[model samples]
Target: MTQVGEGQEAEESAPPVMTFGAPTAGEILAERYELVEHINNDSAGRLVWRGVDVVLRRPVAVVLRYPGGDSATEMLQAAVAASRVIHPNLVGVYDAIDEDDRAYVVREWVDGQSLREQVAAEGPLDPARATAVGNAVASALAAVHATGMVHGNVHPGTAMISDEGRVVLADARTDGADSQENDVRAVGGILYFALTGHWPHHEAPLHGATAGHGRAAIPDAVRDGSGAIAAPRQVRAGVPAYLDDLTMDLLDPEIAPPSSDVLAAELARLDIPADDHFLESAGTLRFTAEPEDDRSPLAAAGGRKVAIGIAGLLAVALVGLLIGISIFGGDDKDPARKPVAQPSPTAPAVEDTTPAAAAVRKLDITDVKIIDPDSRVRDELDDADKVTDGSLDEGWDTQSYNSAKFGNFKKGMGVWIDLGAPHTVKSVQAVVSAGGATAQLFAGQGNFPHTSSGDKQLVKNYQPVGDALEQYDGTTMTFSNGFNADQKYRYLMLWITELPQKEDGSGKYKIGVQEITVQGS
Candidate 1:
């Protein structure tokens, strides 16, 4: 990614203007796509238009560029590459065509505005919403990277939020300059922009702004006297410390950014109701440095000796520290050396000095309900309460399906739990009948009605606490370090997205939750 001024200086003193005939609103391209309305011209001089696919009878977006022979090669390549990846968070590419005069690419038409437009219209989003956006973008990038392709273009304008609250990444550029690492870092930039309403990476040009031409539509990030960009917490109030640390670490060149999948998982873990103040027991972000090469001759000789010397010193220090603790800080008394003193009966009894918050105990679940939105019969509703009945032999189970994803009939099913009152949660552990099922933990406020419509609304309202356990291999799954210690949760949901194969070789998919235990203060 080149800086704005540097990019401008590299261009010709007076660049020639290339022309491709203008397209009319009613004109049809490739005899299949009918243009509806013109959207906008991008910084790279491509025209974007909303169109209709006559054959498919659906809305589409067409991107046109001039001089199709060689100038449009990269654009066409990117479109073809993007078409191969099918993900909910990625804008679907339909077709790419090259005419003698121009080339055009048609993709899915989104009904909502871009991130840049949304931020400009309203203000910065809350921390929870900003985290959701980041998670979506990272998930899209992970899908693209898995196919061994790089999305050279990733910015606020390329990220779109539809009217139905679906976030999609669009307009990939195959310029051969951007790397997978750059795509992952751009997600951090997205978070910064969503939380602070400012773009942190000035080197990457925005959608409508050409580098070195003029100021971008979005404002640059604020910096201190030392020329260091301010963190999200510094720019805005109420940003969580863990989120702030994760955002700044992603932007820092000194710290190695996590892979797209790793970053997506971390963001998913942070996308919860108590995200504003929740802190992970371990550090928010864990970065591992490249291991040193021990094959070198110098390392084999001097490194070994140095490592031995350090180990010897550490061992001696450990012994000395233990002896000092026993002599000066030991809590037990030596009964042989000194007689023990008895307590007076008149003296008041000493109360338990342990803090209540430090202890982890099983929380009483007031109620449990089956959340099966797609099933009209509600076959398994009766056994919902059995999940907390202190028995593992009999519990709730979903109907067996031919496929892992509920036979493509619905999204998922879940068991919703309501604690008697708000409590600081420590962990949630679920014991299933078999392995290979995928599930996630969610937290929210208030319970919805037990109807189908209410179940749909419940799914929408409850935010995920951590990443889904993708194809878990064991019988027990535990979600820990995903809650805020300062915040209490009254409602929780364990949504199962994918089911495991039945053990009896029935050639069907289903899973049963034998028991669910929650530990809290």
Candidate 2:
């Protein structure tokens, strides 16, 4: 449950209890319609059901549940309030009522899979794909924001990518009425995960410019910028420099302090040259009385999103159930799900395309290019002798969390710190295992906050791709795209994963923190 603003109802520590009654399918709501299947649930523990308007025989979703006390009542009330504003991207509320100490609030059902599934199977998505996802959800955000409501919980896991390629956001204006920025921050989080195939905060923090600098540029509450970030090209090849630069720009709130709608519009504008008609805009979003017959945003098969009633969602409800790790990975013990392979030496490195800030210094180790080198990948390591036996002392920290779930050092495991105050950090660098042959950096988080860490963006001014540290271990590369002279840091955190035995030639998994140097003004 999220914390609401002044006017909204407060969250209750104890939620309501719901029991699935043996109500036969076709049972009508308040003896009105024929009940169908269960859809979803509300705060009041009411079970929503699909039903047929027995009188009219039209499809409808009905809400019925065992209610909690004040908290449950308030949640139901909030849903009723949200029912006032209707948007294409938002779920529509039908009605609410209390019966037998159970309060039920009905809403439109949506047909789609959580973004969580897509990311889990495909790993970090491409920038264009990510933008597409973000744009769809951003439209929803725009509508919610216009209504003075914030989708307090917005992320890949929460956003439903319908079969129609449209993203629908749930839990809008539910029990929480947090600040609008909370949704903005959430957008930032989802964007990070989409690109990096991981959460933002699951990884580690970078030695940033200065806490004051990060604060000065970004909103005060968002302090998840891990100092070091990876450039996008490091992960895959053929990525246009323009797309890379755009993602990096969004990472820094100061770079382009625009709203999601504004940025989304910009992306839509980019799509004009290629295919203008596909662009989503107020004109294209024609909402007719019945959304079923409409076909927009093409998908291969289950690509269309059909808005149903509250009962529809319950059929595929994943309430109160979280997988081993978040789609945007979190800081949990690595449950080495599978084995990953080490990156090949011949893997070509992409040219760094990160833009430079006139006011800051740039740190580029171009002369000392890193491909398949030994411990120290410095300018002096040009010779083969130094590459092999260069390391002085090192330690290994391998987590035996869950062997079946979290694969070897991918997106989930990394370094992290809970910041206390502000500090000035210069640079952050580390070396992860190249990886084994079985698994990949699929579970890896962006260097900043790890990929899926919601509410935890690291290195305040870095992108999820190489713009910020996006990859860890081998089979992928991650590092600070550029280090400026005047860096900022308030609190610093670090996330690291151990190189498995197969990846590093030995099982003694460990992350090498060569050094974390701090610079002060």
Candidate 3:
């Protein structure tokens, strides 16, 4: 009955509509997540929404992409990969659902602004604050890279600062197009943006960043006529020289950026005290780039060795400064000051009595396996790598039993560790989820078979290093002094005899090993 002109007018006057299959507020995906509000479309054309998980009764951020199946494979895969890594500085991914027509990822909802937004709104942050943010990002990247995964997206937009002042890195693309080196370089870009309110376009492109000059658009790094980008210190006052050098060195493609853990350690050292003023001295910590040829052999050998080398250098510098201060700190003219005591030149040179301490370094764990002998199913044997994955949040847990003695099924289960080669073991530290669990450290030689019979044989052959930790009262158990420091051990075992009772009222007993670190040289 309606006329054609009238129908056209009604369509024009109606509110703007979302594209078909697009999600809306109050709409529930997978019947558990209820979308609260649509935040915005990300650079990759995915819709970001602030939602709530009705089952958990917690707020969550939902990223939705239309036409799922083959189109949303990358997003789904990245989400799945990211979920395996559990770190405090990383946004926790809860679930990824593929509904054929659409795919959505649910993650922890951060109640704060992105670094880019904060910098744009409040200009540049002080060097101290920027360093803290950079430290958090680097730490997150270290955890990610430990799993051989790359967080392809590391721009300011992905660096989120929560309302509680916690800095977390979010939205890992893992698209395979980027390298770990690129991820490290992007941290430099983040620092540059945080210090100068400009994105380093030449070093790393900021995803979803506009090109224009407005506040909403992230401006490119200021450069000279020679096309070289200016350092952060030149752009802003109060930026520390060391921090400037570190940032520029990271941005420079010619120089290889330090590994994520090394960078994280350096940044952690440089992180200023909360009570200290930003403009004040940054203390004795300094980061300097050394020439390739002049670098120490330990520094050239990457991993924890590099960190140790850098720390050793800093320690030496600090010792020198302390000695100088002691020698020339007081004025001789001050009569109130006490005269320093000097050893007599004629006195016999005292014999150096202190014993040389054995060097303690983190031993490389080449292989790890669960030694479960009783259970035929071997349900708890899969996550053996989690203990050494460098993440405390993810761990290998034993199955719950009615009794602490594993329901009297067998004597106990243990985790075998291979050090790859013979090394002098100084100590073995095991971080457990709970206390009151009975455990012991055992040392064995040769390969230990991964079978029920082999497990029994291992228990019989392996000699106990220390007395059994009967009802250990702390979370971390360190077996030291028990190991023969002069002797080299290649294989070790952490055998857990009793499990801790769960806090839940279920009366079930289980134990989780969060981390196992061996220190030796």
Candidate 3 displacement at residue 16 in angstroms: 20
Tens digits of per-residue lDDT for model 1 on 284-341? Answer: 2111223576566334323444575788899999999978765664545755443335
User: TM-score of predicted model 1?
Assistant: 0.52
Instruction: Give the C-alpha lDDT of model 3.
Output: 0.76
Query: Candidate 1 overall Cα lDDT vs. reference?
Result: 0.77
> Which candidate's TM-score is highest?
1
Residue pairs of candidate 3 with colliding backbone atoms: none
Model 3 root mean square deviation, Cα atoms:
22.5
lDDT measured at residue 109 in model 2 versus the true structure, 0 to 100: 53
Per-candidate RMSD vs. true structure?
18.3, 29.4, 22.5
User: Candidate 3 on 1-521: residue-level lDDT in tens?
Assistant: 10000000011232332336787789988989999987766655567788899999998888887777877787899889999999999989999999888888888888887887788778999888999999899989999999999998888778888777899888787558788898888888889999999987763343333222121457888999988889998899889876787788788776666667656755765684745422223432111223477665454323233576588899999999878757875557888765566669998888999999767789999999998754444567989999999999988999776667664334578888999999999779899999988887889886657776577577767877855666777798877746785688999999887888999988788999999999999
Look at candidate 3 and tell me the lDDT of residue 145: 92
TM of each candidate vs. truth: 0.52, 0.42, 0.50
Work out candidate 1's RMSD over C-alphas.
18.3
Would you list the clashing residue pairs of candidate 1?
none
